[model samples]
Target chain A: MRRHERHEMTEEARQELAAVDAAISGEAANGEHAPLQELVRALRGVRPQPSGEFLAALDARAARGFRRAGQEHARDSSRGGTARAGVARGATQKPRRRALLALPALGLAVAVVLLAILLPGTGGPGPQPRATNAPSKAVFGAAQAGPAVAPDRAALQPAPAPTAGPSAPGEQARQVERTSTLDVGVAPGNVQATAQRVFTLVNAFSGYVRQSNVNSGPSGQGGATFDVRLPSSNLAAAIASLSHLGHVRSENDTTNDVTEQVSSLQRSVGDQRAQRASLLRQLSQANDPQRAAALKAELNAVEARISQREGQLRALRTRVDYTRLALAVTPEVTAGASTGDLTPSAAAHDAGKILSAALAVLVIAAAAVLPIAAVAIAGWSAVSLTRRRLREQALDAS
Target chain B: MTLVAPRQLATPQQRLERLYAESREDLYAYLASLLGDRTLAEDVTALAFERAFRRRRLFNPRRGSERAWLFGIARNAALDELRRRGRSAALAGDLAAEESSREDHLEGVLRRTMVQVALGVLSARERELIALKFHAELSNPEIARVLGVSESNAGTMLHRAITKLRKACDAQA
Candidate 1:
């Protein structure tokens, strides 16, 4: 063999020798082998006989064993009587099923408690909706009077009266008029009184009513609105007096120059009337009947021009003589109502309370499930472990 | 000669004395080997007798003698005790004394030690195989019946185990 192969062979031989050596000094030497064999040989060498005391002890032990065997046989014969005794023992066992069954009941009770804690218990069923049988109210009635005239026709609606008295020096110094608005959470119940107050103030300053609305708001929240025309001369007094009705959220005053409009309309009206007079004069001097008829037609055209100019003058004068006061009246919310406690916040608080109650219910249900889940898991684990152990034991036996 | 009668009418104390005379040594020796402690051996011996006395009515004469049945019960009791305490080095001394009488003494001892170590290293199945073979001393056919394997397979496993033991001992040496 080559050097490496020879080395390998040597290692194998060494291993074989070691195995043989281990086999020679086996486990049997640790038991009764070497010593017992040596003792047997020594006893043969001495005289192949046991000592007197040793034999006597052995004989005595044998006799005692024989007597004991007899006793055991007798005991076996008496075992039939013991069967009756077992029946008596069975009667004394305690009733234990109640303790075992209480577990599920306990769990159910806990769940119920938790649900009670979580649920809002709104005390009783919510109130039933009451029936209402009121007749349907019309939103807007007809104007009630013809465009020309009627007995109940409004001469003038309410307006803001001027606040500035001639004796009040500060008001007298301020000639410019002003107007203001009131903002309320809900409109006030007295719409007519507010409108009348506005009209009286404007009238106090020699202003006239322009236009006003008595019923403005929806039925749920009562209020009204009005637009009054007051003289520019009385606008400042009207605004100051109207502010006394409620709080003014905003106010604004404007001055418009209608001097141009009035002068232009007046001049146009004068020119048209002059033309109509000239046409009528020309018609009297006509030589032919057809010429007179043509002159009459020219006079009618001039008369129409005069009427249009007069109407423009009237409208312009009406606007400048009376200023418009737009008034909005509403009920006051008081300091408490303005503190931001409406449906949204109330709903949010209710939602939070509802969520807390739901969480409580969930926690209780979880508590009820815990013990059962634990028992199931423990039993499963024990059974699985026992099965595994059985497999192991079978393998060991093999 | 007339055969002597059994002591059927003996008191509890007399019965206990008779039981002590017939079985004290054998029970102590077996229990000592099983528990690896003289004190535990004594206590277990007493307990086994008490249990046997209480459950004596269930004993059947057809299934081997009373002594063989009692030994079986004692074996079960010893195994139960071992399980309760968990497997520890305390039981090693008792288990080592079983096969300590053959010609291959040193080799057997080394193999046994290695087998114990191998038992710790094996999966539960392998450990159980080792326990049944040397500890329980069941024959190959009996082991095969218990394991649902053929007798030849059991024998092969036994051979393999012995080979492994020899190799382990050689390696240690």
Candidate 2:
């Protein structure tokens, strides 16, 4: 029964039944209780009491934050007023700066733009336009503005037919239907054949050789010259024939001074005939001395005029019959001049030409690089100005 | 005419908010006793509510009531704040020193004085366990969840701690 009761008794009952309960309660008390009690009193003494000033400071900070936030929101909405306000606030908060630094940057950009605008022609001092050495200037010679000398027409007048010799089969002179001159630079190897072919072709096409001059050049540098005449009717065909001689380099065509000659001749002939009739009449009436003297003086003056006019008309007709074509031909191969390897003089000429071309290209490249260099220099100037502005602001703020 | 707004506009919506509004003074006093620093106690208490509110969705209605869930979160938050302050600050006995200098005779009654003295003698962990048990009034399972231990182990640990407290008081006498 006692064992059964022991099992039923709880731990709480055991604690209450223990004899030392009063001792346990007192002895179990904390040892540092007095120190804790003392500390509680100290805490109550030292704790800061909240005051109005602290609250006011907090309110001010809140207002500043709210104003800043509102301004930012307004700026996002594009009101623009907020943007100005922000700039003002930023300026006040930021350090002071000088306005002068930006001037150099702006000046540099303007200078670059002006330089670009003026660049192509007068941006920098370049070489002057070189004087040209065109071969045409020497070849054609300058035209003068005066009456030209005419051929002696008395000699050009139709003479008595020559006593018969065997008539060359193609000897009949053909009318000049058309005319043209060819320019050809005689190359080596075909100069003689080329010259002969040009002459023969002009004749075959109803043309005639008016003049030919062969210049076997001074000291083995051989060349030929040809002054050919072709019928006016076949002038175009003769020009086309000569085009195949080598290469027709350039050409020009002009009419001779025949118009003035024909007009002067017709007037003088009429005057001479009238004067002759008058002289005959005077001679018939020989009883009158005054009429005889007047007719004699008139006949002398008319005779002089007639002689001048006849000469002009004959020269004009001769020119109309003959058309001159000038040709220059050089030997295709000069055995002594180019027999071996390239001559030193020829190599030197080629090298000079190449060097000139390369220099021209380099000059163009340098001109191109100048603008890029200017732009880079301008960019550096701008960055330097901005940095200087920042430094000045810092200094001013300090 | 513009209408004037009311001054006291507080309206409790959640369990944590209700508990905070209803028991703030008691909770602050209990935490101040546990932590010893008023500011630190206030910070930990406020942080506990913030976390409890954030995790309110995780509370199981079938497992416990709102009061128990909030208490669990608060108890854990308070203990975590103490642990992070480190062992030296925990053992400084600043709270015990503050409790002794009270001018109010009613606050310094024998029973309150006895409890205060007993708390000062206890370790930080023991004080936390006692707070969770009696002041925050969390159950053993709730305390275990806050402390990250099993329910049976929490009970056993509490029993051992209480037995030690009783023996220490007896020896002090």
Best by lDDT: 2
Per-residue lDDT tens digits for candidate 2, residues B31-64, read 6555565555544444445545556568776765
Worst 10 residues of 2 chain A by lDDT: A137-146
Model 1 lDDT per residue over A1-398, tens place: 00111112244433433343333334233342343232222211211122344334433533443233223423444432432122112212212534555666686677677656555542222111112111101100111110112112222222333344221356443223234343322223334445555554456456655666666444446566766666655455445545544434445555555566667788888888888878877877889999888888888888888888898887776665555677676654331112223455545554665676566666666766777778857876997567546433432332
Error of 1 at B73 (Å): 99
* Candidate lDDT values, in order: 0.46, 0.47
Largest TM-score belongs to which candidate? 2
lDDT for model 1, please.
0.46
lDDT of 2 by residue, A10-87 (tens): 455334322122222333323424332332333223222222442343234323422343234335344324333433
DockQ of each: 0.05, 0.01
Docking class of 1: incorrect
Candidate 1 segments whose C-alpha is farther than 4 A from its true place: A1-193, A206-211, A215-220, A334-398, B1-173
What is the alpha-carbon interface RMSD for each candidate?
A: 16.2, 20.2
State how far residue B155 of model 2 sits from its true place (Å).
Answer: 2.7
